[model samples]
Target: MIGETFVLKGNDSNNLIKENVSNLKVYSIDSVRVKHFFTEKVDYIIEGNKLRRTKNSKIPNFDEHVVVYNDDGTFTFNSFPRNPPLTIPFQLYADYDFSDFDSIYGNLDKSFLSEKLKNKIAKREKIKIGVIGTSITAGAHTLEQFYHNSDKDSYPYLIKKAIEKLYRNEVVITNYSQNGSSIDYLGDVFPTALKDNNDLMFIEFGMNDHIYSWWKSNLPNFELTMSNSVDRFKTHGIDVIMVGFFQQNQSWDLEFINSTIEYNQSLSNVSKKYNCYFADVNKEFSKYSQPKINQDFCGDFMHHPTSFGHLLYYKTIIPAFLKEDVNDGFIYNLVN
Candidate 1:
């Protein structure tokens, strides 16, 4: 299906679609359900409001990718002929479909995370969390809702919201995040991340860490500085959770992954070194998104997540408070 031609869906029941979405520019950080779309290289014609592919096109088919929407307001694995149903977050003409947003937060090992939450629940104490990271954690590109709290959609704030919602405990957060900065610099802002004797510290500085490739050649273990920061937090009796971010690239054609994932691995090692939680949002993002539009969670077609993206972050996070009796090992993941 790589070189196969296709058509955009209209009133027809089939899922083929290709309209002049030229008017529908897609840097939308505000849409919900049908998550967001990045792009691809292709040519098409809009005839009778149902666009179809020309002689040769590169837009992958439902078989290759999984986001082909049918006219019946239901989408599946795209190639599935109703034997099974599926949903994805690719908004078309505001036909938002959040019916299956939870599918991405696949199975996460919650043992370490749940252990931390048990102490909080048993004591019913107020939770203080410290956040340090790049623009994404600082609420970049995501517009705050009118008549709502500012930066409420950001993960730090959402983390607080999720904790209170699930545990009924008071929560306080100190977010000292700087935009356009990587973990190398942003992780060093001291006194701020150390204030209030934080119960938990969330380190989120991997998106802007493209400097690691050169830093690797010029420096020691690239994550050394971040590991130091985590050590300091741990020294102060602060629990650390190295939050991982998803990358914009989906192709693993080469053995080389992007810097964020590189940092994710580094941070994963750091988490293992300290025995703490490493919330793998990167894996969650990969599970829900299409390859061609891998950066769909990112609003700027880069690294910042939309409000919905932030919500995904929250949902993926809150399961840390898993009930001991809950049989399933995952949160928000559905049986396929």
Candidate 2:
């Protein structure tokens, strides 16, 4: 491995990179190849536990751009920034190998989307997308207080941006996802969400749907509601993509984690029964989560995941539309 990586939660008010970065031998720092690819010593000096930026360096300041970073044990800086600048400094790898994403997509059911995506790309038709879920699906992030791009950086928008880039289809997203909502809440807006006539729909609800105290009893209702919602869309001729949501650090209780796993199974069952697209991102999240020494995608250490988390969400969902040999360097171009 090149070196251990980490993400700082955010930048300090002064020129300091907060968090004890003294232990992390950070060789590179950047956000979406747009801002400074900072070099240590040359860019800033490490004073005690904090890394400070040089006064005159080209490195983006909080005013010009968002300071962010993420990896393992390093500061929890995650998510790539967008123009107008968003997210903090992320430790980006110019030579990152996306081959690992192959395994992330390996468990997905692609039989339903290949034809759909190919047809859309061939005709060059416009795509309308609808996403319904709880906060995580709604693009809830800690950076929203400072930046407004978190919504644009969510998995829903990420998937929308990716399809537009790869298929050349003009994609428009109508995200009805809200924070703290349950499967029952989606039931309330089912009428309006279905009216969009979307070419694709991304549904994520396992997190909020889970009844922490009575998860066992709620499984049936969760499955029923999700199935009903998906059925309504499918019946209306809309293609749907569903994934199992996983919590990082927030709920590690054996029973709680088990409830989430059961919820994932419910999602799998529904997707299989409806013949819709499904990706088990819970597996992918595990591949990078802690005990392996990497920053968790969820920046809050709870609900809202940073851009890196959303990136994982996008990679897992888009494979259903991609082909066996379509992997490329240009595959990821999500900046809208």
TM-score of each: 0.61, 0.69
Clashing residue pairs in candidate 1 are 7-16, 7-17, 8-16, 8-17, 8-18, 9-16, 9-17, 34-89, 35-89
lDDT of 1: 0.53
Residue 40's C-alpha lDDT in candidate 2?
59
lDDT: worst 10-residue window of model 2: 92-101
Cα lDDT computed for each candidate against the true fold? 0.53, 0.59
Could you give me the TM-score of model 1 versus the true structure? 0.61
- lDDT tens readout by residue for model 2, 84-134: 122234432111222222332332234675466447766879988888888
156-218: candidate 1 lDDT, tens digit per residue? 786676456656889888877777777666446767666567778788866656443363442
RMSD over all Cα atoms, model 1: 12.8
Candidate with best TM-score: 2
Superposed model 1: Cα runs more than 4 Å off: 1-117, 145-149, 211-215, 218-221, 249-258, 288-295, 324-336
The candidate scoring highest on lDDT is 2
The residue-level lDDT of candidate 1 at 158 comes to 68
